[model samples]
Target: MALKRPLSQHAQIIFRAGVESVCGDRLIRDTVQFGPTEIWFAEHCVDRQAIDRIILVGAGKASGAMAVGMIERYQADAASAGLIQFAGHLNVPQGCERIPEHLSWPDDLTLFAARPAGVNEPTSLAIEGTDRILHWVSEATPRDLVVVLISGGGSALLVRPADGLTLADQLQVVRQLSGGGADITQLNTVRKHLSAVKGGRLAAACRHAPMISLVLSDVLGDPLDLIASGPTVADHSTPHDALEILNRFDPERSISSAVYECLNQAEQQMLAPEAMSNVTNLVIGNNAVAVDAAGIAAESLGYNHVMQSARRSEGTAEEVGRHLADMTVEMLRRDPSRHHQDALITGGEPVVRLIETSRRGKGGRNQQLVLAAYERLLELDTSEPIDFDRLVILSGGTDGEDGPTDAAGAWIDGEVHRRARHLSLNAADFLRRNDAYSFFEQAGGLLMTGPTGTNVCDIRISLVDRLN
Candidate 1:
């Protein structure tokens, strides 16, 4: 059956393009769609017979699906898949064992799941039950080909303390750094230093067998060492950098003794000649692939657009929003009499600064950017009369989620302030509280799309000259 493109399908198409591109036929061809098993085959099956036995272990939000895909792909017979599905408490090298844990199918739950175990939502413990999984991996011999599937959330999912650090200590530091707004690269650097499965240590463990990594990236620039702390990849971050991050952020703060000891061991152990010789890494998906898919979708929709540089993105969501708005305004100003419609495209992650006050409301980076741009536009109108028809800025998280809200973001337009005014909602108050959800709901700007089943940070689209 052919799918129909609706009037507002441009946004929908772009969003789906970003998500579906990762699992497209070229990528998932014969695999069981996507799962740990599929990843295993992609990495190991290339030289199947020589590889006597295959050991698959992975952690991530996409780990389960990726694993399932692997099971359906390479194994010439159902025995391999069946073996994985029925493995006991753990599976050793050449044995197939599907880990019991998994990140929530979607992202918001995955994010909230980071809350301490026993809290309201899913906890880090619910995903890859790392401690148990690793104890099994520790038993593998050099003859096994250890295949690791890594993606976002892999770090938390595969949690295993180095020597003495407790899970509690790991969680505390994770919470502090995450809430403190450290970037993924920095957070993962510290995390890599304090764990058994991170910072190339996992690769170090599989020294007996040739190891291959199949990764799905969530880091902005796709730094292998930063994604899931580069479990099976060589790490370049130094202990000095990790300690500096902690001291600079909280001088009085001290990591658990176990963490300190682990850091010391990592520095010494990582330098050994035999530690990382057998490892190979391949990063198959990222925001660029998603962005290219979006660009293709836009062209298919008959809209012209140039891919923007996500690498140059900086500052808070609003600042980026303003920059987007400025670029948009200038683009429109340059040709107020444009005879055709065009879309501006960009994809990347942006930072969101949660206000210190308790009044903070629901909103993600995507929605906040829209809110910020609207606020700026309104402020601009007060000093000078402006025309805003036929112009709208669309932004949202690729996963169909934003911040802690139901709506990803919105189709922000000039009517935002007037609509909010009519509803007696204070736009400034909403922005101040970081409450973009409420503002957009009242303004009828919400761009809701259910779980897209993929994560690549944020996607922004500016629609201009709609009917020119």
Candidate 2:
């Protein structure tokens, strides 16, 4: 018999495979190709002869890498370089600005730091970056073409307040909504109403110029109108929708008069502006792509894998974690008369509801989810004693970020679980205080990968031995 590899190592490989499949740097080039006189997005082509310039404008964690891909195309394709000029701006979190060692930071295309690393909220710098993008789009003529690279984190990276609202008011409202456990759709509905650029407004800014938005979807079911607040896609939601969501989260209406007033005023404006048809919004990558690739990786590693991607919000982090734990127990206790290994891969984003307490500690949704799973594993009762030696579970953010922490996510196996028990760690205590990072740090199951150059929600892997 061949010696088996560590399940932890296998989980990391599968997770990384998922990230690479949707990597912005690779996805962008794969979607667009230079064919003599045309640039292709799948089958749709833009004529190089008619283009005076190629304007790039975007904001998100993956946009920086997509921008690099564009630059690479410009350098490698003689048709693109000779026929069109490239100029524009991108709003990205810090560390995303790192480019290949061989490439110099070009003057024409600016990759602005919209917000600092680890912070997921809108900042003053984000507002500045948004303005520059708007200006660049405004400068484009009918002869020029615009390519907008969008991905997850664009909501925080691209910021513009509606009339009567300051950045602080917008931030407070969003934070409160998130803390209240509102899903991305509800949160983005509010954000779109509060922004001058989101909800098809960015497409409206294109005016007469031809625009194309390549989106890497992070929202469930790849809802283009909700991902990054749909800056290029038409808004199907209304200000009333935004108001209702806000009310659900904050019945007291303590989000300040400015927020409500802005929503009321937004009713006068059209939801999908007339210029919405001018832009073509394409979902170039999504969670399913990552999940499918992860399954393939699992199969290659001598495991039989099944995959799923949630089409809607899977509820709170704890709920999803517990569900995953239940799945793991079933797998661990399954009949394995046949000689094989079993693996399950899933992708979707889960919410983390913060409890208001001075004793709260630091952690993200992935960490919280893993901790909950750990606790569930300890509490479950099996007909026979569960042998977890060959079982492993992991949940990670494809963007290499989970909330405000440096770690991407976490993993758990028999060895790590035994370690936790040996240390007399109470998983429930860490979970209640929302401090999974501290628990995992000592328990030895934290998965840290600074930034993986992609974003497509979250991917979770569960592996078990099904040996004869």
Candidate 3:
């Protein structure tokens, strides 16, 4: 059964199909398999007799599913090898195990509910979980195989403050950087310097053990050292880089004194070079994976699909929205015959620079983008001869959570302006207040999808259909 709303139903189907394509479980299954004499994963093969133990240590929004996938793959091989001993410790967002149809793993793997589901901030609980993971990694020997699952949100899910820093201090720094609109790279640079587990420290703890990190990339460009703050990968960023980001984004210097001191100390005593001789980091899933899947799905629905590379998804939310709307208008004009269906798919996370207001409103980056697009469409000259009903635009966070709102994102068509007028709502006023949630709620445009158990950033789609 489809959702009663036609536009929403179509958008939901396309987006869900895209997300499912890069799910940790599916990626793991495709990358790992067991042969009669060797265990094969990606391009690497391990002789069954050469490994003494399998140790699983990871933290992220998708790590739980990744852990489950690994366990299932190995369990299937247990009958041939006779009881493969494995111990796992993973830090996952709370309630991840509750995802519908999520597979259950063996009792040997211990799952830690690190951060509260839907909230991306680090907490004391996440710190404890990171400690446990570190302990497990430290116990690994050269004969053991260490598998690390790193994905989006791992930075927060596996929180461990550096020496002389408290969790509260780190939280304050994160809150400031996030509210000030610092990009992922900037935020992670600061986080890596201030954390005990990030910036390849986790890899250092593994000592001489052979380690493989299967990562789901949420950062644009799929920078291995930036995803999840690169806990198991070598970091190229320096302490001065973190200090620069903090100073540039936090002009007021309102960051706690302890954080300032930490950065200052880090400038002189930065983390040592990571040992990479024994580590292999593989990016198994990324925004491109999801975007390509979405393009295929759109084509299957009889739409001519054009995809924007994952790198093109960057920019401010409003600017990105206007760009998509303008692109749609141009496409319709070129196809005056209106005899074909077209879909444009894009992937990347856009920033939302919150406006300063006495009263703050609720909304996320995706909602803001759709709202801005609606406004841009309304301002287009009527002489453009574009039929609004035949076009629909959607932007959503692939993780099923956008910003601080429960909604993944929002969708809009030509009718949004008329509906807003009937309600006597000024779209500009809502946009100024950064309250796309209320505007969409009244206009029937919000797209709500609870935690999707994965994160690869955001996806946007614009569909134009032939006039009837």
Candidate 4:
């Protein structure tokens, strides 16, 4: 008899390994090209004669680094040109300013301060400084090309209320939609309509000036409008769309007073002479690039497997897990003479909404995904007699962190739950509390990769091979 190899087991390991490799510092550097400083120099010096001045204004998570990079390049180039004494220093990019501290206006010209801890951390932006970021963007002028260096957090950071809206009103709307389980597209649709810079309004500001946008997209499909709320891109969202999202997901929450007024004002502006005229935005990088880079590494390592489905995935984390699990089993059964070294990879972000009264558990979406796959595997075992020992299921966030948990994600064999039972921890109980972190820790299934600077949604890889 030919040897019977476990297809799922190998697939799981290969996928996890791919994700870890891509999320590392090395890959991140190769993938997200054009440091802020580098782009600044390139953009400014592109046509020294035609463009009188290369004004640089950088923003987003990478702004600090981008500014620094641009400044260095400018200094080097000016030195080569024999211009010994340029007006600006070389240590930092000229025209690039550090992100301003949070500025909230209480009166016409008076402002209040609300700087919090973890100012640059993910949760910190989600909590504070969102509106301030928008105010800064809104302050840009027509003399500027408005080169926006956008990354993942741009959406939250580019927080501005539509005309007549207060910071509190914007925050309330954002909190309700985000906390209510609205998907990214839907959440951004609302964000675009409620902001001065988002959804092409910022682009509209420079109706007569040239504009260039270099975006590092965190959205699954690299949707331009959704990334950083599409500040430099035209918005397809309308006030109606924004209202629809709020009504569909958060009808109970009263619209903040500021929010209501902003919507009303935007209605009038749509009738204005110029809404979208001088905006050109480009998504220079995204999760797909990361996924492709990871896939290439896998192929180079001799995996030699074509991705089964590269389509961006949606729905809940559990649903994605169930679907992936079923797909893995189906692939193994259908391809009898399949090659010994084949794998399947998929990338996308999945949503997980917590109920109001339900306490969030320790794990992020990745752990939950693995758990869901395990349940599907168990169902398969119970419904019919089959060998599952060789199969593996793996899922993880590409950012290397999930839902405040120490572990990035998990890897599991068919015996995962069985082993968990052996350790006296109920798999279902842990999952019920949204605590995949505990379950995986006990089962020795958690995978850790600290602080992968790149954010590329989620990556799922499955490897299956026939026995020799």
Candidate 5:
């Protein structure tokens, strides 16, 4: 049986193309190569004979695939460079590796199950895995080459609570900040201070071993210190900054006393600048790379007036969605007959603050954003009727997972609104309860794409066809 594509086939194709272009495997293959006597990674070339060992250590959603790519590349050149041995440990999301049926990992390489599938919260297993990573780094000699694969979700996968804080304490802090609508920078500020391995501490453990970090950035701007909380990079953020963020996000001080104490003591105990001298952090891929590819794909799909969103795409999902919708509507109204079709592309991770309710809701930021946009478009209909059949709005996570739901995101068109009305569903009510996932499921608006093996945040594309 042939698989069926989604109704929004062009949008789906553009998104998939963009994500695959930046996937860990492809990124590694593009930036790393082996020569006769030297190995080239990014711009750095190392003499294979001079290096005694290559140690891989890190964590993230993309780290496992990145490691696999690195291993394969190294093995391809092993015949020429037999002097260097590759080994180490990594913490990756469960079921990330698509191991071949006949082959298994090398005995020296250790891969640990860190986080469960689709759940970003850290677990006890992740802490144990992080301990092994720290231990491996501690044993590295000056002749060792540490290749760190850091990406989105590393902050959770590489879990090691500060000395005074327990796993439970860290979990509580994470829950409070996440549910409170804290952004990545604020969340990472607290995380770096509360962890023993974050904020250059992982590099510090190497004890002067040369380290190269190939980072697949999920954060905006690719701030070296914030991507995965900068385990292998120098952090200028202080304990005072973490304390301030906690006060702003956790005003009630719901975090455990141990976490508070750990942050308070972080000022004096944080890793010194000199510890990061041997570490080099490079952002091999990011949201802009994904968005640029998306735009190119959109252009190829015959979107005559494609525009990329200028805003940074932060704030509540609902607000961002409404803003995008308004932008689309304005573009169409200004020159409805000038272009046959238009596309507006955006990228960034938005936050969703759960409504206070005893009942749990199923949805993610992308779903909420699209649902809210639908409500806004309905409002616009009252003032000036829109061509219901011509507009399509889609928002999806680049990682192929959104919130706790299996769906990557949702798509909203006038047809979806009609379907919701036919089913007697209220979009505003669903938004209030944070139940966009349920609403979309009934309206046929949910977007599902199983694990794309990459993470760079979310992408939103709004399509307008005035002629239609």
Candidate 6:
């Protein structure tokens, strides 16, 4: 008989399987290819003979690996070597800017650090890099085949504040909106209005060049126009849309005066959405892909798995966490030890409305989520004592960084809860202050995986052990 692995180990394996499936480099290899006759971008094919230059520009965490994959793909096809010139720029988070030594890292293609390692906001470096990309794209002609690699974090990684609005002003608007509980779409709607390069402007600048955008979606339902603020896809949203979101979030009229001025200008200056450039946007990977991959991994691990990838927002982090905890409880109620096959996998982006307090603790959405789940277990109203030894429940960001913390997210089990009880920690106290990282630190369940080099939002796993 085989020794059954720990349920925690099984849960991680399933989660990692999902992350690895939609890895930027792996997705690039799977979706892009070079041929002697033509180049393939997903289902679309382009005649190689007609293209003279391949301009590569991207912004996001996964772009470095995508650049590496592009280089590898180009190398693998010895037949097409040196037939066309390849050059461009990429704006990535700090650590993702560097390529592995194993690949032929080219000088012509620039990989720039757009933001600090832990901070996920637009920075001066991001603006400079965006400048380079705009310049590079503007230089492209009809002979150039432009490829834009877009993924999560691209919105912050790619930034050029609109005229008359300083970076601080734009950042302030975003900060106010985020603290007010604005969803990703609403936030990005505002982002598109505040930026010079975002919202299809990047592609529109090089309207003469045929552009292909490879999108790795972190947003729910893969709305191409909203992902990474839709640099390559046209924005159908009006400036009125942005102002409406601001008014909804900041009803007190506290947003920067410059932001309001900029939006008013954009309403008059911005062209009709239909008048923008034509670019083919291809969604190469997303949360659904990750969720499906995780289900396969569970099946391979000999567990009966059920999967769900959220098509819409799943509400607050605490709410989603409690739901997962309830799911685990319902599954446990069925007494799965006799059958030995129960695994639940879910994927989606959850909102984290930060508590406004100077005493607030540090944590990302994933950590907050798991902490909520732990609280739910403690609150369960059951006559019989719940079994803690046979369960593993976890949530983590696919990019391996959750919120502003170093942790990808966090996990919880009966053993971890016991440790918390022994430490005399109050989960509710921490939960109210938005500090799950502190609770998990003392409880021994913080999931720390630095920068997975890919982002497809978040994945959660629930696993139960089998009787041998």
Give stretches of model 4 more than 4 Å off: 1-45, 49-146, 163-171, 204-209, 254-258, 270-278, 308-313, 334-337, 384-389, 414-418, 465-468
Local accuracy of candidate 5 as per-residue lDDT tens digits, 190-220: 8999888999889888895788899999988
* Order by lDDT, highest first: 2, 6, 5, 3, 1, 4
Task: Flag regions of model 6 displaced more than 4 Å.
Answer: 1-4, 80-82, 273-275, 381-383, 466-468
Worst 10 residues of 2 by lDDT: 381-390
Q: Give one digit per residue, the lDDT tens place, for model 4 in 368-405.
A: 88887777766786776444454566777665667666
lDDT of 6 by residue, 102-149 (tens): 776666898888898778889999999999999999898888999999
Residue pairs in collision within model 2: none
Give lDDT tens digits, candidate 1, residues 1-468.
111323234666676676687641224344322233432434444444334445666665554445544543544354443333211021111111223243112111112122231121224453245544454456656545566666665666666666777777887777666556666777788988887778887777764667777777778878888887887778788887887777665556655666666666666655453587887787777778888888888788877777763753356787878878776665555554453557788887777767754777877778888878777766766776545654567787764667656676786665654577688877678877888887887787788874444456677887666344
Candidate models: Cα lDDT each: 0.62, 0.87, 0.81, 0.56, 0.83, 0.86
Error at 258, model 3, angstroms? 1.5
**Model 5 per-residue lDDT at 428:** 90
Kindly list the per-residue Cα lDDT of model 2 for residues 291-328, writing each as its tens digit.
99999999999887789999998999999999998998
TM-score of each: 0.79, 0.96, 0.93, 0.73, 0.94, 0.96
lDDT: the better of candidates 2 and 3: 2
- C-alpha root-mean-square deviation, candidate 2: 1.9
Misplaced by over 4 Å in model 3 are 1-5, 80-82, 99-104, 336-339, 356-358, 381-386, 414-418
Per-residue lDDT, model 6, residue 19, is 91
